[model samples]
Target: MKFTDGFWLSRPGLTPRYAVEVDDIRVDERAGTMTVYASTTRIEHRGDTLNRALLTVTYSAPAEGVIRVRVQHHSGAVPVVPAFALAADPGFGPGIHVDDEQGILDAGGLSVRVHRTGGWQVDFERDGAPVTHSLARSVAHISGGEGTWMHEQLALGPGERIYGLGERFGALIKNGQTVDSWNADGGTSSEQSYKSIPFYLSSRGYGVLVDSPDHVSFEVGSEVNTRVQFSVPGETLDYHVIAGPTPKDVLRRYTGLTGRPARVPAWSFGLWLTTSFTASYDEGSVTEFIDGMAARDLPLSVFHFDCFWMREYQWTDFEWDPRTFPDPEGQLARLHDRGLRVSAWINPYIAQRSRLFDEARERGYLLRRTDGGVWQWDLWQAGMGIVDFTNPEAAEWYVAHLERLMAQGVDTFKTDFGERIPHEGVVWHDGSDPARMHNYYPFLYNEAVFRALERRYGVGEAVVFARSATVGSQQFPVHWGGDSDSTYLSMAESLRGGLSLALSGFGYWSHDIGGFEGTPDAGLFKRWLAFGLLSSHSRLHGSSSLRVPWAFDEEAVDITRQFTRLKMRLMPYLLGAAEQAHAEGIPMMRPMVLEFPDDRSGFDADAQYMLGDALLVAPVLSADGAVEYYLPEGEWTSLLDGSVQEGRRWVVESHDYDSIPARVRPGTVLPWGAVDDRPEYDWADGVTLRCFQLPDGYDAETTVPGADGTATAFRVRREGARIIASSSDARAAWSLQAGSATATADGAGTLTITIEDNR
Candidate 1:
């Protein structure tokens, strides 16, 4: 994707043609959008124009502060794969004007300038100052044999950092990296990512999203030290420049353009236990694990069955192996009786060994080769053919099988393995280009399954543990970091990837606790247990070995028990934060910078994160149980022991299995739910309101949702002698505990409380 040889010259056999001169400028008759047509070659005379190449430039404003510029070289070439922009109708914004004498096209506050009559240059300026510039040779139409590409170069500051290419495990800051927006099955150790988005937001508060689903190559301060370049192989290049004064504002605007993430169910925040892949598990084994957790006083919510639940090599058959699970219905009913949800593993590919494969082949539901036969491969399964989700009949057939499983007590699905789509010599039912469908296949596949789940289960109750995604895949909740090794290093990398994904408009994210490839040491397991319980969603899954707590050590069980109960008790506050994530585009598991944008110490702190806006969680990544984390200028109290610590300093401490670096910020009113054994109880009943150190005259409010999904707002304001608590909706039964706070109410949804400053 890098076409330049150092700073001055282009690589051999590559012709980069950039727009030089604007031949004409006009406004559309109806839409009134400005269009500028520029020629690639600068013609000297009238006779020299016949052989010169021309690239057309059409610039317009789709919305305020959003400019769309399309550059095309050959008009007769085939349309490119990976269609740009996923939204159905983005609507229109303001008008555009062309000032020929000034040599600039003004699109609202943004301006594009043409320099030297033929040497094309566009400068995006705000208040008569340049924020970013696209020079003459920066925008080029590239050609090499049958493949063509359009490249764009935008200015990058000297020390600005870039972030948010989806689910990347390499670095928290994406400087000096060559990233490819292509989905691959590479594990956590490699540069390849399962969720690759062609959008990056800089520290300077601007973001550029390449509107392509196909592969996009990005050189972030790599090919040129001062510019960030991206190229997509096609006839036209389209991109949007979004402006924000802060990174959170950029995300808000970006998600406004794309779609915001949907709200997941409240119970999904609880701990999930899985039958580890390839591990020997039967009805007895499942019961033992569940009973073991209950015996150890560990709270569990969801029980998942891995691939071995079905017969080997027949994954999509959707039937449990009779030998292992002879009575799946009764078993699931028993688990449900014990107040646990059930999830099963499934993928889109149907193996030849499955009986449904022939039915699909006869129905023309599988992707076909050029010769009109089913495309089969032996990569994961023998003669496995991918379900052609482009075909409506195929989607219906796939959903029918899943609906049968849902009839048998399956609640959710682990929609896995959409990254290995084949792109060569294949055909799609809807006539979509195969190369474009390669990355977009996951979107269609997950949407089909998710919509089917919603049809059976009601809305706000459907969830999927998906692995891969495209632009608009944020609509599907709860994607996990895929395929990591069992080590502390991999745990840190998983956090980095999850934080990156959250920054990319994903509301909820999870990961394999204690990794998925190998059996982690006891230290890693206990550490990961605390980290997983603090996540938006928690699951214990692995390969080869069991992820049962007792397998590691007795302390691991205690660690899991304490954190699981803590998360269950914190559901009132967590679910409120989740509601905010659904309302705004901010992430629940936020990076440090998102919470503390003014704090310079938090910009590079990837090892820790702010759970919502109040709590800071720094998982210990070392074997010694030692962690060094920083808090911004405030008073932070330990959520585990209620010990107070001052901010603006690095604190190093050793912790046992029952404790880690978890703190609640000051001026926080956290609601502790009544039930710790189940997550579906009425959270507002018997809610123990815990108030942290409140600065003088500061006010905080906590809203607790009732069983009917309606929330009651508890307003608390602190004054000199007393604190006042009031309710807006109804008279909710509540109590205040901790810090010697005494309460008295007047029956008009108002209460006055006084607290002594004991601290």
Candidate 2:
């Protein structure tokens, strides 16, 4: 996608037509749009414009603090399908003005101004302060070897860092990297990604989203040292610029346009034990694993059956392998009786060897080629034909099978393998462009299943362990990191991907507890156990190997039990964060920069993240149990050991298997649940408000969500030396704890506690 060889030279066979100056600026009052027709070459004379190309640039306001820019070389080409589903307000009227010298379109606090007669340039400002701009020679159309592309480069401020190109496994900061917005099945160690969202957040309190499901390549300070360049094939390139005075504000506006993640179930946040992929598992082994956790005092919530649950090579048949589990219904009932939810693995493909494939092919529910033949591939499964989720009848047919599984006691699904969609020689049932549907297919596939789950289980109760995603796919609740090795390097890389995805507006994310590809060492497994259980969702899974705690060692089992119980106790705080994600777009597991935007030292801290708004979790990534992390300006109290650490500096801590850097932020009234056995219960019942280092005159309100979506508010304030806590809905028991002192309240009352050892 790079067209320039260096600073002043163009690559061979490349014809670059750069926008020189604006010739005409047209304002559409009703549409809230400003269209600028720019001559690709300088038009000094009237005859010079006769044969020159004119690039059309249009800017429109979609929502408050959001502006969409569309650049086109030829306007006659048909618009592409499978575009992002943007939520634009129709009645929003932007302030627009055009003059002979300059034109401006203001959308809320963000405005874009065009230089009418000067060298083609558009400056974007946040409340009259310059943020970025499309500078000279930054917009161009390049044609080479019968293919044309349109690209736009935006200026990057000094020390500005970019993040979130969708679950990236490389460095957390995206500076000096070339990223392509194409989904792939690449593992955690590679540059390719399973979820490639065409959006990036800046440390400078702004974000950009390229509006294309097709292949969009981005050169973040890579192609040009001072600009971020994005290009797409064919005539048009559309993108959105979101303004934010803070990273949280940027995500709020961005997710408002695409979609916010839904609220997942409470049990989904608990410890999940999965039958590892390609491992030897049946009713006996499964029962043994479930019973083993209980025997070891490990509080488990969900049990997942991986791909081998179905017959070999018959992925979408949705049938439990009779030879392995002749009674899936009764088996699932036994797990439910043990207080566990069930998740089954499924994909959007039908192997030809299965009976469902012929049925789907006959019913025209499979993707077809232009030659009128069914599209088949031998990648994951032999002769596997993808289910055409675009067709209404086809989606219904697919969901019918999922519904049947639901009837058999399946509570959720792990929607996998949507990244390998074929874009060549395939025809979509909805007549969408195949190239555009490549990345977008996952959205439709997961949507069909998620909507069905919601129909059956009700809203805020459905969950999916989906692996692939694109624009607007955050509406589906839970997604996990795909294939990863059982090494500390892969563990660190997976954290980078999850942190990146969290910044991309995803609320809930999970990964394999002990990695996915191979068996992890005891140290690695025990270390990852703390990290995984502390996530929004936790799952223990692997490939061809059991991820049971005993698979590593006895210490692993003890560590797993300890973290599982700890996570159960932290449900009240985590559930409140989930509710916030549903109401706004902020993620539960937040990057350091998102939580502390003013702390420049924490901008590049990816290994550690803020779990909800109170706790900071720094996972131990080394076998030696040594971890380095940065804390912003505050007094951080370790939730694990109750130790104190002063803020505003980097700290290295060595932890045992049962501990990590799980610290509570200063000035936080964290709601702690009394129960430590299960995730679902009366969350406000016996809740303890743990007040951490309350400075004088500090007051805040904290809310804890019930299992059934009910929320209760608790008011905490510090007056002199006493910390007082009061509840709004005190139908159940509550308490307040400051250091060693504790005070209790039965119902509709207030409790006060005094701290003796806050230091």
lDDT of each: 0.82, 0.91
Models 1 onward score TM values of 0.95, 0.99
Give the C-alpha lDDT of model 1.
Answer: 0.82
Q: What digit string (tens of lDDT, one per residue) describes model 1 on residues 239-282?
A: 87776657787777677777777778777888899999998899
Please identify model 2 stretches exceeding 4 Å from their true place.
757-759
Tell me, by lDDT, which candidate is best: 2
Clashing residue pairs in candidate 1 are 20-118
lDDT at 333, model 1: 92
lDDT of 2: 0.91
**Residue-by-residue lDDT tens digits, candidate 2, 1-759:** 688999788899988899999999998987789999999888889999998889999999999899899999998987779888999988787899898889999999899999987798899999989889999889999898879999999999999999999999999999999999999999999999889999999998899999999999999999899999999999998999999989999999999999999988788888889999999999999999998999989998999999999999787799889999999999999888889999999999999998899999999999999998899989889999999998999999999999999999999999998998989998998899999999999999999999999999998789999999998999997999999999999999999999999989898899998899988888889999999999999999999999999978999988988888888889899888887788799999999999999999999998999999889999999989889999899899999778999999999999888899999999888889989989988989999988888899988888877765577888889888888888868578898888888899997788877666553
lDDT score, candidate 1, position 719: 85
The TM-score of candidate 2 is: 0.99
